[model samples]
Target chain A: MSSFLVPFLFFSLLVSSVFSDQAAFSSHLLPRPLILEYPENSVETLQTQLRQFDADELTLQCTSWRVAGEANNLNPWKTIPDECLEYVRGYVNGKGYLVDLQRVADEAVAYAKGLQLQGDGKDVWVFDIDETLLSNLPYYKDHGYGAEVFNPVDFDMWVDKATAPALEASLKLYQQLLDMGFKIILLTGRSEAQRAVTEQNLRSAGFQSWDRLILRATEDHGKLAATYKSEKRDEMLEAGYRILGNSGDQWSDLLGWPMSTRSFKLPNPMYYIS
Target chain B: MSSFLVPFLFFSLLVSSVFSDQAAFSSHLLPRPLILEYPENSVETLQTQLRQFDADELTLQCTSWRVAGEANNLNPWKTIPDECLEYVRGYVNGKGYLVDLQRVADEAVAYAKGLQLQGDGKDVWVFDIDETLLSNLPYYKDHGYGAEVFNPVDFDMWVDKATAPALEASLKLYQQLLDMGFKIILLTGRSEAQRAVTEQNLRSAGFQSWDRLILRATEDHGKLAATYKSEKRDEMLEAGYRILGNSGDQWSDLLGWPMSTRSFKLPNPMYYIS
Candidate 1:
C-alpha cells in the first residue's frame, strides 16, 4: 500500500472508533428501568371518594345511568347537597327526561316486535313495581323527596292505605305489552307481608292483569338488592320463561345474568339500591 | 260534641265515614314503593364498561380529568377506535393540552410560593413517573397507543432502551419545585428491578435530582393499582412528609390517601389503571 493510503486508512479507523464509542457512551448515560419492592409504608390505603356532581350535572349523569341500565338507587345522590332537591324534581318532571324514557320504551317496543310472541307461555316481560309501574310522587312529596332516611313503618302504613296511582307512561307501555301477548311478571322489593295491599294497589292503579307478582320472602332480606331481583328473573328463565324485555328504575333491577333481550330504564333519581 | 241535635249528629257521622273511605280509596291509587329482593342472577356482576367519547370528545374528557382528577378508562369506550389515535396525538402535542398543563403548573407555583418552605424536610412534592414527567411516545408509537393489551416484555425492552424524553412542561415545573426547596419524591408503578435504568433515564432525560424514587415490589403485583399507590402516599404522610402537591397521568396516582394539598393530572387517554 502507498504511504498516503496507509495514513488515510488510520485516520478513518480513528474516526470510526470515536463515533462508535460516542454512541455507546451516550446510550450508557440513559437511565435504566427500575424494579422496586412494594414499599412497606406505601400501603396506607386511601379511601377513594365517589366523584361529585352538582344537581344540574347529576341530571345528565342520572339520565345517562338510567338509559344505560346502571342507575343509582331511588334515593338522592350522596354527593349532591340537600339544596339540590328542587333541581332533581326539575329533571324528573322535565321534558328531556321524559323524552329519553319514551325513546328507550319505543326502542324496547320495536325490539319486542321482532320476538315471536306465540304465547307458548314462554314470552315473559319483567316489570319492576316501584317507579316502573307506580308513581310515589305523593309519598315523596310528603316525605323528604328521598333525601330523608326511609321509615318502613310510615311507608308500610302508606302502602296499607293502598292508593298508589299508576305511572301514566309505564301503564301505556304495560297495556301495549299485554296486547302483544307478552305475559307480564312483576318483581318488587316490597316485603312479602305487603302482598295483599300491593295486589290491591296494582289492580286499583289500572294494571288489569299480570301473570305473577313476586315479592321478597322474609329469608331473602340479607342479600343484596341486585341478588334478590336476579334470582326471581333466573327462576322464571328456569321455568321456561323467555324474558323478552325488562324495565326498572335502578340498575340492580335490570342487570344480572340471564338478562332479558332488552331492558328499559325510567328516570328515578329519588333513590339508589346496591 | 252533640250540641246541634240528633239529626245533625247523624249527618256529621255520615260525612266523616265518607271522607275516611275516600281517603283510603285515594291512597290505593297512589304509587306504591316496591321492595325488591336483590336479584340472584344479577350477581353475574358484569364489569361496568367505561362510557364512550369521540376523538373531539376525548380531548375535552382528558382535559377534564387533568383538571378535575376524574377520568374514565380507555376500554369499553366504543367510540374511540384504533384509527382515531391521531386525535390523541393532536391533543397531547397540541397547544390546548400544553396550555392546560401550564395553567395548572402556574397555579401550583403560585400555591407553592405561598407555602412556608421552612426546609423542615417535611414540605415535599410528589410526582408520578410515566406520562407525568417523561413522554413514552416513542414506545407507544410502535405499540398500540394504549388501546391494546399491555405486553410487559415489549414494554420492558423499551424501558431498557431508556429513550424516553422528559416532558418539557413537567421538567420545568419539577425544577421550579426544587428551586423552591421542596423535596422531590417520585412514586411509580414500575418494578423495583429497573431502578438503575430508571435513574439513568431520568438523569439523561434532564431530571437533575430527587430525594427518593419508589417502585412497586413483587408482592404488590396483585394489589389494586390505586390501593398500592395510595398506601405509599399514606406512608409518606406518616413519616412527616407534607405532600403539598402531586401530579400524575392516571387517577390511581392522584387518588390515594395522604393526598397532596393539590393534585394536577396530565392527559393520558392512552390507558387507565385503577
Candidate 2:
C-alpha cells in the first residue's frame, strides 16, 4: 500500500468501528415509557373518594360556612379547616409565590422589549384590579382566605378603606409598562359603586396615570364574571384600542376573542372565580 | 491613573454601558398578551351560537345525516355540510397535521432514550390501535371522515377485510422499540368481536410481534372509552407490567394512573369520544 493510503485506511477503520458501536447501541436502546405510579387503591375507588373532597365543592362549602358564621355557630377565622389552611398560609406568606411572579415579570419584560412597537394611543395594556395590582392580604388575613365566606357587604367596607398595599412585583411591572409608552387600562369586577374607592386604593398603592378604569355597572352585575370580563375586552376592541398586554389572576379574564397580544397570570389559588 | 489601570478602566466603562443598556431596556419593556381575533360577530353572540353547535350535537347531527342518506333524500357523501368537511379535510389532508405527529414522535423518541431501562419482559410499551398504529384512511376515504355518520356495521366490514395500511411513523417507532428489547402491547378500543380481523389487519399492516393485543369485551361496551381503557391499564399494573411508553390518538388512552414513562400523541381531530 502507498504510505498516504495507509493513514487514510486507518482513519476509515476507526470511523467504521465508531459507526458500528453507535448502531449497536441504538439497536439495543429500548425506549422506556414515562411511568408514574398510581395511589394504593384502585383508580375507581380513589375517584369515588375524590368526589367526596372535591376542591370546588370544598371551597364553596367553606365560603358558605364563613358567610353564615353566626347562623351556623362558626368562629370568624377559626372555622377554616386544617387542610385548606396550609394552602392559604402558603399563598399569603410564601417566598415561592413572590418568586413566581418576579420570574414571569422578568420573562414578560424580555418579550415586550423584542416586540418594539410605535406607541400610538391604541397600544394599550389591560390590568385586572384586585389581586393583579394590589394585594388583598390584609382582608384575607383578618377575614380568613377561602376559610370564611366572601361577604360583598364586608368586602365593600374594606374596599372603601382604600388601604390594601401594592403588589410589589406587579407595581414594578406597571412602572415598566408606563415607561414603554403603552397606555394602561384597569378593568375590574368591582361594582360601579366602588369605583371611587377603587381609584383611591390604586392611586394610593403607587399606581399612577392610567388611561381608563372600567368597572361593572348595576346592570352588568347579573353577568357571569367570565362573560362580563370578556365583554369588556370586546368593548375595548370595538373602541379601536389594541390591547397589547393583560395581566390577571383569573383564567376567565384571559380567555375569549380579541384577546390581548399576550397575557401574564399572577397566582391566585386562594380562590377561584367562574 | 497608572498606565496599567487605563485598559481596566476602559473595559469597566464598556461593561457598565452594556449593563445600563439592558437595565434601560427592561425598565421600558411591556409584555403583550396572547391575542386572537373574533369572527365578525361580537364574542357574546358568537358564544351563544357555539352553545347551539356543541361538539357532541354536531357529531350526532352529521352521523344521522350520513346514515340516513338517500332515505332522507340526501346525496351520498354530498350531504356533508361545508363547515364539517372543511374541518375534517384540514385535519386529514393538511401537511401541518402530519408534521405535528412527526415532531411529537421525535420528542417522544428522545424522551424514551433518556429513560434507559433494562429490557426485561416487564418493560412494555402500550399503543392504541386505529389512528395510532394503523391508518383508517381507506375507511375514511369512503366514509367521508367525520362529515358522514360512522356506521359500526360498515366499519366492522372494513376491519374484517384487514386492508388498512400501517401508519408509517408509528410503525418505525414500534420497530425501534422491539429492537431495543421492549415488549410491545396493543390496547385498542376495538371490540373483542373484531379481534380476529384486528390481529390480521395489524399483521398485514407490517406490525410484527407484540406481547399482547387487548380489545374491549362485549360487557365493556357500556363503559365509557376512557373508563374502559383506564381499567385495562390498571389490570396491567396489577399483573406487574411496567408500562414504559404509551402512544395514542386520544387523551383517554394515555390518562389515568400507572402512566407510562413517556407518551406520544398522534393527531386525531376527526372525532372525539367521551
Candidate 3:
C-alpha cells in the first residue's frame, strides 16, 4: 500500500518533468488520486518518510547490488529485486542516476575529444538504443520499475507511442560525437519492425540523424543480445567502419568479439536484457 | 586543515576495529592524541559529524564513480578523490563494505557449490591476494586511504612485515571452495621475492594451503597487469587445470582471454590498477 503511495507521490512530480508524453497524455488525462490530498503532517506522509528511511538504510547495499549489476557481477538477472524498488525509484527519479549518466557522457565525450579521428568519415560510435540513447521510463514506471516480469505487449505499445525521450546526457554525447566527425550507429535489441516509430521517436527526442540505425532482424530473434550485437559489430568491421567508442547500458551491448577500443557503460539498474 | 582532521577522526575508530595489527602494532603502539580526549559534544565531534554529513551527500556520486570504475567505466584512476575520503572510509569500515564482500563471496561460493567437479581435483578458483583475500587496510590507512599518491617503497616495507589479515568474507569463501573440492590458486601481483612472508601471512590469516601461489616473477617486470595476469591464466589452461572461478578486486584480475565461466568482482574503490 505504501509502495503504491510513494510511487504516486513521485509520479505527480515526474509527469510534469521527466517524461515526454505531455502532448500525448496531458496531466489531466489521469485523474488526481484522492490519497494525495492528505495534509503535510498526515500519516501517509509519515509512512512515506519512514519507508524512505528504510530504503535509505538499504541504499548502500542497493548501490552495491546496482554496481555489482553494472560490473556484470549479478549475471542473468531477469528483473530488479522487489526490495530495491524504492531505491531504484529514488535513484531513477532523484539526482543519482542523472549524475551518473552525466559522468558517463562526460567520460565518453572526453574519450571522443581525445580521438585522432580519420577524416575518411569511417569512424563510428556504436550505441544501444533503449536506456542508452532513449529512456523508456514512462513505460517502465508502470511496469514495476522493472521489478515485475517483462510484458512485451504493453512494452511494444509504449514503443509504438514513439515518445520515449532522449536521455539528456546521451543526447549531449550524441551531439558531441557527431560534431567530432564520428558516424552514429545505433545497434539495438529492438525489433526491425519498430524502425519507423523508433526513427520518429529519435527525431522527436532531438536525435536529428544517424549514419545507420540497426534494429534486430527477424533472424536475429532467439539469439543472446551479446551474440546478436557481436555479429552486428563484426558486420560493421567488415563495412570498413573503425569502431572507435561503444556505449551501452548493458554488458551484452558491450561484450563479445571485435569490441571497440573503449566502451562506456551508462547506469541502468532497471531491467537486464540478457 | 579539515582534511587532516577527518582522517584523524576516522583513524581512532579504525585502529580498534578495522585493522588486524593488534599484535604487531597494538592499540598502545600508537600514543593517545590530545584531541581525542575532548568532550562528547566537543568541537571536534561536531565538526566531524558535519563533515560526515557533507560526505554522505556526495556518496551517491562517488558510488556512481566507483561503480563506473568497477564496470571499467572510469579507467586508469590514480587514487580515491580527496572529497570522497569520509565516504570511502565509511563504506570500507562500516557494514557496507563487509556486506558487499559477503554477497560476492556468497555468490562465488554458490557457484562453486553447484559445480559437478571432476574426480581429478583439477577445478581451481584463482584468487588475488591483496584486497581479494588478505587486506592491506592497516597500511592503507596511513597512506591517505589511497587518496595520497602511492608510495611503493613503504608499501613493500609493510608487506614485508607479513601481518595482513584475512578479509573475513573472502576467507569464508576460501574455506567453502576448499570444502567443495576446488583447488585454491593464489595468483597475485605480489613479487615472487615476497613468497616466504606471503606464505606466512596467508597461513596466519587462515589460508592454509593452495594448489599454487603464482606471483610476479623478476622477468615479468613492467608488463601491464592485464597482460601479465592473462598470460598466467593461459599458462594455467595449458597446464590442464579447469579455471572454474576467478575472483578479484580489480578488473585486471578478471578481464583478458580464458576467463572463468563465471567471475565475481569484489569492490575496491581505494585504488585503481589498470
Candidate 4:
C-alpha cells in the first residue's frame, strides 16, 4: 500500500508542473501571424474577422500598458523589451528609413545651406516639437494610456518634470545648420503661456539656439477658420523670407505655400490622427 | 545789383529747401504707386515700362547687403526701418487689409483642438517670426543700409549679441495659446547651427516656449524639395497633426495642402513675392 501511494503522488506532481509551464507560455508569448478559415459565401464575415484580428494585434502590441506601479507594468520603453525595440528598429530600417544619426545631422546641415542660398529676409523654417526633435516615449510609457489626450495644463507639468535628451543625431544636424547661418524659428502648437517651461525644456535638451519661438496665439476671437498656417506663411513672406524650407512631424506643417525643401518624418506609431 | 542778388539768394534757398525735402522724403517715404501711360498702339512699350518699373522696385527693396561686424561677413536679415514699417502698415490698411492678429490666433487654436480631438500625437504651428511675432525694425534701423538679405551666420551672432523684446500684443496672445497646450514649432530658413543664439534671442524677446525649433539644413548637400513652409506642413501632417493654423506675412506660407485655419497676413508692403 505505501509503494502504490508514492507512485501516485509522483504522477500528480508531474501533471501540475506541465500545466504551469503551459500557462506561462500562453501569457508571455509574442504576437504571431494569424490564419483565418471561413465558410463559402462568408466574405463579409471574413472581412470583419480579419479587421478585428488586426485591431486586436494592434491593441495588444501598441496600446496595452499599465501605469507605473501597476501590476505587470514592466516599463516597456525603458526595458527596451527585447522584441519591441528590435521590432521597431527593424521596421524603421526595413522601410529604408535613415535614423542613422549622422545622416539626420547631415540632412539638417544641407537644408541650412539651401536656406542660405535663398538668403531672403522672409525665408525661415518652422519646426514642431514632441517627437520631431525630442522623444517623449518614456514619459508616455510611464503614464500608461495614450488616450488621455494632450492636456496643456498636464503637458506643462509633464514637460517640467521630464527631461528630454537631445535626439543626438537630429540635434547635431540642427546645430550644424545653425552654424551655417540659418535663422532658427521654433513654431509650435503649445500654448503661449507655457513659454517658460517650454524654453527650459529646449535649453535642457541642448536646443537653446533659435531665432524666434512662436507659439499659438491665445487671444484669437474669430470664426476659427483653420487657416492659421497659411496666415503665418503669409506673414513670413511679408517679412521677407523666401522660406527655403519648413519641417515638422505632421502634414499640417508642410501644407502651406512655397513648399519646404524636404519634410523629414520621425516615427510615432503610438498615436493616431483624429 | 543788390535787388538782383537778393532775388538770387531767395531762389537758391528755395531750390536748396526743395532738394533737402526730396532727399528726406526719399529716405523715409514709401514708394508711391505708379500708373504707366502708353500710347494706344504700343502694348509692348507698356509691358516693357511696367517690367522696368517692377524691376527697379525690386532692386531697391530686395537688394542683398553684406553683413556687418561678422568674421565671415555673412548676410543678415534686411532691415525694414521704422519708417518703412509705418509706411507698409499704412499701405495695407489703406487697401482695406487687416492684419487680423486675433482671428489668426483663434483659428490656430481651433485647428489644434481639432487635432487633439482626433487623438493625433503630432502638433505643429509654423510661423514666420520676424514681422509675425517680433519686430526686427529696430535691428534694421540700428544697422542702416547693409542689413537687407538674411545672413544666417551674421544673424546668429546678432541674435546672440542682441536682446529680443516681445512684440507686446503678439506675445500676450502667443502666451495664452501656449497655456492652452499647443506645441509651438518654429520653422525658418535660418541655418541649423545657430540654435543656441536663436534660443537666446527668443528667450530675451519673451517667446520662451517651444516644442521643436528647426532651422534650414544648410550644408553642402542639395536643397530640400519642398520650400521650407510647405515641407514643415507636410512633416506636421506626416506626424499626424491636423494642422490647426499657420501665420505669416506672405502667400507662400499658405500654398500647400491640409490648408490652415484662415491664414493671417501681416501688413508688409516693403517687399513683394513674385
TM-score of each: 0.42, 0.40, 0.80, 0.34
Model 1: per-residue Cα lDDT over A122-214, one tens digit each: 899999988888877678777766767667789888888888888777888889899999999999999899999999999999998999999
- For each candidate, report its DockQ versus the true two-chain complex: 0.01, 0.02, 0.17, 0.01
The numbered model that scores best in DockQ is 3
Any runs in candidate 2 off by more than 4 Å, and if so which? A1-82, B1-274
Worst lDDT window (10 residues) for model 1 chain A?
Answer: A44-53
- RMSD, candidate 2, Å: 24.1
Candidate 2 local lDDT, A1-274, one digit each (tens): 1111222323333333334444443333224220122233334433532442343234333322221221111111333565656445543565434655565566467656666667678888899988889888788877766577677788888898999999898899889988888889988889998898998899999998799999999889988777888898998899988888888876557655556777666655455565
Segments of candidate 3 deviating more than 4 angstroms:
A1-55, B1-56
TM-score of chain A of each: 0.71, 0.69, 0.80, 0.57
Error of 4 at A126 (Å): 1.9
Model 1, stretches more than 4 Å misplaced? A1-80, B1-274
What order do candidates take by lDDT, descending? Answer: 3, 1, 2, 4
Q: Who wins the TM-score comparison?
A: 3
Off by over 4 Å in 4: A1-106, A111-122, A145-152, A220-226, A272-274, B1-274
Candidate 4 chain B lowest-lDDT run of ten: B64-73
Residue-wise lDDT of candidate 2 within B23-48, one digit each (tens)? 44333322421012233333553353
| DockQ of candidate 1 against the true complex | 0.01
Give lDDT tens digits, candidate 3, residues A1-274: 1111224333533343324333334445447542353344344534654454455446556766887788788757778887788778777876677888998999898888888998898998999999999999989888888898888988999999999999999998899888888999999999999999999999999999899999989999999999999999999999898999999999899978888889999889898877
Structural RMSD, model 3:
15.5
Per-residue alpha-carbon lDDT of candidate 1 for residues B146-201, written as tens digits (9 for 90 to 100): 65666789999999888799988889989989998999999998889988889999
Candidate 3: residue B46 Cα off by (Å): 15
lDDT string for model 3 (B128-213, tens) is 99999999988988887889988889999999999999999999889988888898888899899999999999999999989899
